[model samples]
Target chain A: MEKGGFCISTMASSNIAILLTIGVITVLVIQIIYIINRSRKPLHSKSPRSLSTLIVLGSGGHTAEMLNLLYVLQTERFKPRYYIAAATDNMSLQKAHVFEDSLLGKEAPEEVGRAEYMQIYRSREVGQSYITSVGTTLVAIAHALWLMIKIRPQVILCNGPGTCIPLCVIAFLFKVFGIRWSSIFYVESIARVRKLSLSGLLLYKLHMADQLFVQWPQLKEKYPRAHYVGRLM
Target chain B: MGDIDDIAKEKRVVFVTVGTTSFDALVRAVDTPEVKNELFKKGYTDILIQMGRGLYIPTKSTAENGSPALDYFTFSSSIADYLKSASLVISHAGSGSIFETLRLGKPLIVVVNEDLMDNHQSELAEELAERKHLYCARPQTLYKTISDMDPGSLVPYQPGDAKPVAELIYRYLGFPVD
Candidate 1:
């Protein structure tokens, strides 16, 4: 009985040592992965090109307006590297005109019209209720931050809520040195526009924006930095 | 002839779609006597009311035993087919609906989103209205505008004017000058 007990104790210690070895191996593997991911990340911590611009048009009308702007850019001589992040859900309006690679500034007009629906859903969920689902909101914020950091745009231009809200947060946090931010709106006059609700009230409160673009001349008096650029579409 | 065919032949179909953002609000606006009466006066008998995105009209009738005033198509791929045969299209001033109407070259009456943050649709409607391509009105003015629409005067979108808007955008985005 004594001899049997000693053998059992030795077997138990061997099993425990094997388990500890496996656990240590797992910890080391995880550490390696973490280190590799951190090292593989791009070294460029700031905007790469001195003149690169990022334009984010939230899902609907703002996207349409941005599309018009994109169309204009195609005809112009300026070759500044540009990044356009459009809200995914609103791609139905521009599906016949823009493609994923093209919107990313990768391809030509011939490749322009083919849209990938995944990108659309990804962009559209911006400005939605984040507090309603924190997991989804965090994932969205992570994706936007990833794209903005990778692109490292010099100036970020915003039209409205979804993409702009997140991109603004990202720009404010990680912008290194030369990058700036601006906002634009298509309004005929303050009175001509019907302020709908809380968002409109919030929009009126964006007093600290680097600059504001309005179509009406009268708005210049209210938001002095609001450049009267006439009607843009 | 059968009842389906008879209904199809005599019925000049109209499709009314509104923004899903404020479906209840839009339905309330359309429930007014003037808007409902104007639909009857406009010669539309068979109507399909589609609430795109958010709003879903629960029943064809608002109350029990109510005569079927609206036929709800919750989500149908055949919407385009209906648009092709539709004598008139009434919808909110969403870019998707407005673009589709222009593509089909159909006469339309658009109600701008009065409840949106910036009233962005108002700008879009006014721009299209300025070209005389479509009729636009707020909920308050909708009855008057819909009553004044002349289907014979409807015109398709002309492409030249679109370029200027694009050009202005390029300048604003600071694309390189040649």
Candidate 2:
């Protein structure tokens, strides 16, 4: 009698677990469908409304290409910019400032400083081993979570960079919670002629980015979702 | 800076840059007698190399050794001035280095770093080379590339504009056209 009762209890618990899994999966599918539909909606406003923009700058070539992309950026619509770089990358931070100064060089005094720059810890440094990066990755995620919550940006832009992953995840979480939809625009680096960068791959696979731009036409062919809008740099 | 520009104008300079990374094989390849002799024969009066933290130095390049006036530096604040001064540029397959040189209308030979796992830059170099914008070579074939390069035969690369991208982004975000 005891054995039979124990088997029944175990079977009931297993059934409940399976039902819970299905429920979570169903909710996820619905959320994804809703988000996709929401992004497709043509938003129209009578007056010029601005979005608080977030730009993540990676080191060296990534920063160079992003600056080129920003060269023709319509700053009027994407104002009050926020720039994020990795903590170890001091040069990228300096370059960002220089680019900002040049951008607002001719503007009014009050509008001179329309951007904010911040740095976050990297999950893995260049040449770092993957084994130890798990610990740092969690740290980076926590810090990114804090920044994403604090800024609550409406638009997120990043090219090829490792730093964008954590922030994009948090932005995605915010979207999932229905707090806000921080539309992500991922631009594949011009250097990536044949393939997507790791960050690009992750965001593309997860459908985290609302729009993904590939510079190379062949790359666009490989990744159907990517829009081939010509090379930016 | 003005003096350097004036000096560069008089002497044909071939600037070799690894572009902020250690490509020891490339540095070692260009530092050889065969490469130096080839550059000298091409009427390149001077060769300036930005070695980029590489341990090997091209010390064999000297007038006594029948090579052109050669000099190398580890790093520079900006390589734009160097690109501007160069009549020819042989650079690592970095897009920034490639575009900078091409925009200046200099003949270029891009040397691909085979050690790197990412083969994307190789495609960029190869594609541009196929279009006759620049020549592409590995460290091993650099000597032959330098010998056969015809700067006159190449066409200048038309740089792509970023304005379309900006417009696309705005449109994708549901912003209406004015």
Candidate 3:
């Protein structure tokens, strides 16, 4: 009777061990699949295919330069383009309207209207206290995340500005999680002659931008990876 | 005296614009009694200032009734019109103001605000000055710089065609610019 009990106990132990091994293998296989899927190039990385682009318009000079850059592109190719600015920056929205008018010129009014304008709360304002900045930054992040999910843009473009920080961060997080839906392009303002602006510095250090363009050659030397594209404005 | 009258009769307009940001230092520098006297002596009849959000308002009275020679507003949408009419523009070294002033072919004196963190205004001022497109002045040297400006020597600003900037952006966006 004791021998029979020992045999049964040994069999039960082995069965438990076998089940544990199978569970480990299953977990390993699942992890391997996830990693492989994450390693895969993003769907939009296939080629220079036309894509929906989100252009972030900062206040003042940033807005002007972005408009100039947009004017240079084949607007027809970047179908379903979107322009975003800070909530307080109605001037930028007006400017975007002017750009839309110029680009559409007598084409489809419906399509012209489709080029949407969005506004997010500014992350920081000049002279804002640090506490206020933190509060606004959190709000901006939430707004940016929502916008990113909704827009699902293939490309995002911005010149250096405080307002662009949250959007870029969300884009980077999306990329890391293999969402791979959007690519960020940062252009240093023409006003930056010698060194990177605050926004440029952050994006450069974090490797958030896929392509960084500097208007001045000297700036490219400071940031070797930055493409020394000539003045944009 | 006769020359002053002749200059006054010419209706020379000087536009001191702080752009959309306030720079109390600049407004203060321009508002000094010495500076006002110098400007009046130089025959500046009208001064239109776009103060933006600056706290300091000009307190000096005008030559007539001490009513303040400077007329300032918090903001204006018709800045381009003012730029076109102004013979000289004194502004903080903001790119927007500089470019607009240049585009209008007006003589510009940019006062670089060095207090701001990593300010690029000084560099911009230097580059534009080197190009003979405008003059740059520091807050300390502002009065001297403005007093000595020769508007006749200012080279008409010619901006590069927007084609290259656009093309670069197009190429960056992965579109072939035909």
Candidate 4:
């Protein structure tokens, strides 16, 4: 009787251990699959379909550079585009209008006007305090997440800007968690001839951008991972 | 004090633009009596200031007479119109202003806004000055710098083609580049 009781106890303990081992293994497999999916390359197809692109427009020079870049893209290929800018950046919004007008050019204004424009809270203002920046950054992040959910863009393109940080972060998080599929392309500003701007530095360090392009060869040398694509503006 | 016609005939017009961001320090520097005297001595009869959301308003001064030789606006979208007629451009070291001035082939003197977070403008001003494309001036020394500037000596800016930038974007988007 004593021998039988001991055998039963041992069997129960072994069963528990086996159950725990299976649970751990299951978790490991799920984790591996998640990482693989997150890191997978963006979808590529031989037969091209129209892609929805989210372009983050920074104020002033960034706006100008981005407009210059957009002018060269095949507009038909990147249909139903969206533009995101800071709420305070009236100039950028105006520039976007100018860009749209230039593309429309007295022909089919209503069709091209389908490209949407939205604004996110600015993360930082010139001469703002650090504490204020932190608060605003949080608000900006929330706004960016909301916009991302609404847009569900296939890809995001941004030149260097502090305002782009929150959107990039939200996009990266969504990509990692399997909430959405989107690739980020960061083009270092033409003004950044020698070094990456603060935004560029952060995005590169975090691996948020799938592809990075620098205008100058020297900048590419500094950031080996970044492709030297020559000047854009 | 002199008449507008008299000053226009005697002195070169200098356009002082601060872009879209407020640069009260630059505006204040330009507004000083000492700076005004220096400007007058240097043959700048008319100073058109594009203040751009600045709090400081140039006080109406009899120094330039009733015609208000110092004309200022809070903002204007058509800065190119002003740029066309100005003999010299004094501006804050914003890239937009720099590029626009360069595109217009105007001789520019850039005063870096040191108060900015990264001081990128100072670096840009130095770079442009090194290339002989523009001159860099300090807020304190703006008047002196303008007094000595020779706009004719500055190198004409050559704008780069945007095609390369467009091609890079195309390649990144997986579109076939022609």
Candidate 5:
């Protein structure tokens, strides 16, 4: 009777051990799957609908290129929300229109116009001068600083001459702050001598961007860092 | 900008936006005396309105406002309105404009911007024109191209499903998605 009792106790203990082992293994497997799924989901799926991209739109051609890029991003495997920082007086309405009308379950980029942002320079009228208002410029710089602190995009894709200078400066700062950032410029068309004024010089230097997309091959020489993306038209 | 809109309301119109860069040479070629004469001969422009940046001697011209930049939420609604209203769209060789034009199935004539330091827009415009997706005009031939283009000749736009730019961003960021 004693031997039989001892045998029964041993068997019961082994069974409990086996059950505990299985339970632990099951729990671990579930944890692994949860982690995998969390990683696979959109970065902001849990967070508020934050901007994944800060795309700056220049007055004309650059606006178009950036819009096209937005469309491309909407269809990509990884969709991140984007915000448009258009140049002052730029009527980038058409590109915005395309985004609003996409059928591919792509939401158009949210417009964060220059209103809240101050113009660095004041002009008698919009587009009268190529320069930004002092207020607007300060606002842009401040916005960049704010974005680094708040929105904190993984990368910035800049497409305009107007904001390239601002965006690049911010991006460099972000890199220093241990945030990863990259930039892209659209050479929608080539530069001319007459268009090569002071701001133009600044813009040209700004075009020494991290990654430049030029429609023409000659632009490659001017910007060794540029990639000839075969005319983004 | 206001003037163009005010004038456009009264006439049977053709809307042109060649973008904001100075592609003067290309515009000049397409709108050459010969080209303008041809278009006039063809009667394509009952009224022509040119917008954005270019130096074309239009039968009538004004820089149409792009649409006042608005916050994204509101601007989205207005952009659709502009696209629906444009009758015949003439645009620069910018991909965004072309894609929008194609997507709308609007009659389009793309005049490449050649006056830039480099002539990339010309090449792109030509390649696309060769595909029969759009009509290409140089500045000197602008009038001739306009003359020859039938409102019906604006070919339906074709698109491929590749997100190269987005992919580039994702890959750089080490996202698992393509």
Candidate 6:
């Protein structure tokens, strides 16, 4: 009789375990759907005019393309900008500083909508073998998490640079939580006429980037989610 | 540091820039006597080569006996300053150098560094070239391209406005557009 009781108890526990698993999964799915619907909430009549913007700058070509994008933006609306670059990228930050200063006709951009410069460690350096990048990538992500919490930007903008990946992912995490939903905007480099860049591909696949811009129409055809901006650089 | 205009008025300069990456083939191609002879025929009095990590460096000389003056530098903080003074620009197929020169209304010949993976730069160069904005050439065919160059036939590139992109960003962010 005791053996039959033990067997029944074991069956009951197993059934409970299965029930718990399904319950957790259902809650998760519901939460995911809720978040997706929440992200789609458009501007109401009460939306704020100014945004705390985070601009991801990178070496050479990426920096130049980003700066060109900055020129199009109405600086006042994107006030109190945070410019982020890889720690080793000295030129991008300086160029962005000069650009912001130029906007205000000043030597230093002391108050060009309160612009600030931030540097993060690059997850992978140019020509770095992928074997060792795993560790460095984790380190970069941790560093990016810290920066993202500090900035908590309303909008994050990046071109095709490896440095932006960790930050964009963290921004999506923010959305997952009830933290500020910082929308990520990615612009594919004009030089990449045919393929979506590795960075572009990542953000697209993960649904991290809210809007993806491609200079070439061919890229848009391949990446259906991408908007054909037509020669942004 | 002297005026680019003053220098440009003195003698027609052809600026050959390999951009930041080494394109040794372009450096070597420009150094050829055949290419130099063609440049001279086109009334280019001087050549300023921004070598950019190239293995081979061209020897500098003055136009003593009507031979073309040749000088080269490794890199510069302001390649735009050099581009401003040049009558013609032969640059590696870098978008930065290509657009900077084109936007300045200078005639540019974009040379493809075939060594780079997939030759992505060629696509950008070819598209612009088709629009009659610049000439596209390979290192092997640079001499032929330069010899047949017609700067007057090229059209000035109108810089694309980013206002539309800005508006899109604003709309997405829910910032009301003025």
In lDDT terms, which candidate is top?
Answer: 2
- Candidate number with greatest TM-score: 2
Q: Regarding TM-score, does 2 or 6 come out ahead?
A: 2
Q: Which stretches of candidate 5 lie over 4 Å from their true place?
A: A1-52, A59-61, A72-84, A87-143, A177-233, B1-37, B40-45, B48-99, B102-141, B144-162
Expressed as tens digits, the lDDT of each residue in A6-84 for candidate 1 is: 9999999999999999988897666545433432232233422234455554555456555555554442132343444
Chain B TM-scores, listed for every candidate in order, come to 0.73, 0.89, 0.83, 0.82, 0.59, 0.91
lDDT of 6 at B51: 95
TM-score of each: 0.55, 0.90, 0.81, 0.81, 0.49, 0.88
Q: Per-residue CA lDDT of candidate 2, range A117-226, in tens?
A: 99999998878889899998889889998888889999898996778988988898888877777889888888887878899999988888888889889998999988
**Candidate 4 residue spans exceeding 4 A from truth:** A1-44, A106-113, A124-136, A229-231, B1-11, B32-42, B53-68
C-alpha local distance difference test of each model: 0.54, 0.85, 0.78, 0.78, 0.50, 0.84
Candidate 2 residue lDDT tens string, B30-85? 87888888988888888899999888877744554568888889999899999998
Poorest 10 consecutive residues by lDDT, candidate 6 chain A: A36-45
lDDT of 5 at B66: 21
Q: Residues B13-61, candidate 6: write the lDDT tens digits.
A: 9999998879999989988888888899889899999999889977788
Which window of 10 residues has the lowest lDDT sum in candidate 4 chain B?
B60-69
- Candidate 4 retains true contacts at a fraction of 0.32
Candidate 4 per-residue C-alpha lDDT over B1-178 given as tens digits, one digit per residue, 9 for 90 to 100: 4696785566567789998778998999988877777767766677888998889998755445323268788888678888888877889987887888888898888998877777766766787788899999888888788777777888987776667755655665567779
For model 3, residues A1-233, the per-residue Cα lDDT tens digits are 99999999999999999999998889776754553354232332223656788889988888888877877666666767888999988899889888888867856765544588899888777679998889888888889999988887878889968788888888766665657556677888878888798899998877777677888788888899777877666
Tens-digit lDDT track for model 5 on A127-147?
Answer: 544464655656667765665
Interface RMSD of 4: 2.8
Look at candidate 2 and give me any clashing residue pairs: none
Candidate 2 DockQ vs. native: 0.54
TM-score (chain A only) for the predictions, listed in order = 0.50, 0.85, 0.77, 0.80, 0.53, 0.83
lDDT of 5 by residue, B25-89 (tens): 64444434564445445433333333435444433333223211111111132233454566656
Ranking by lDDT: 2, 6, 4, 3, 1, 5
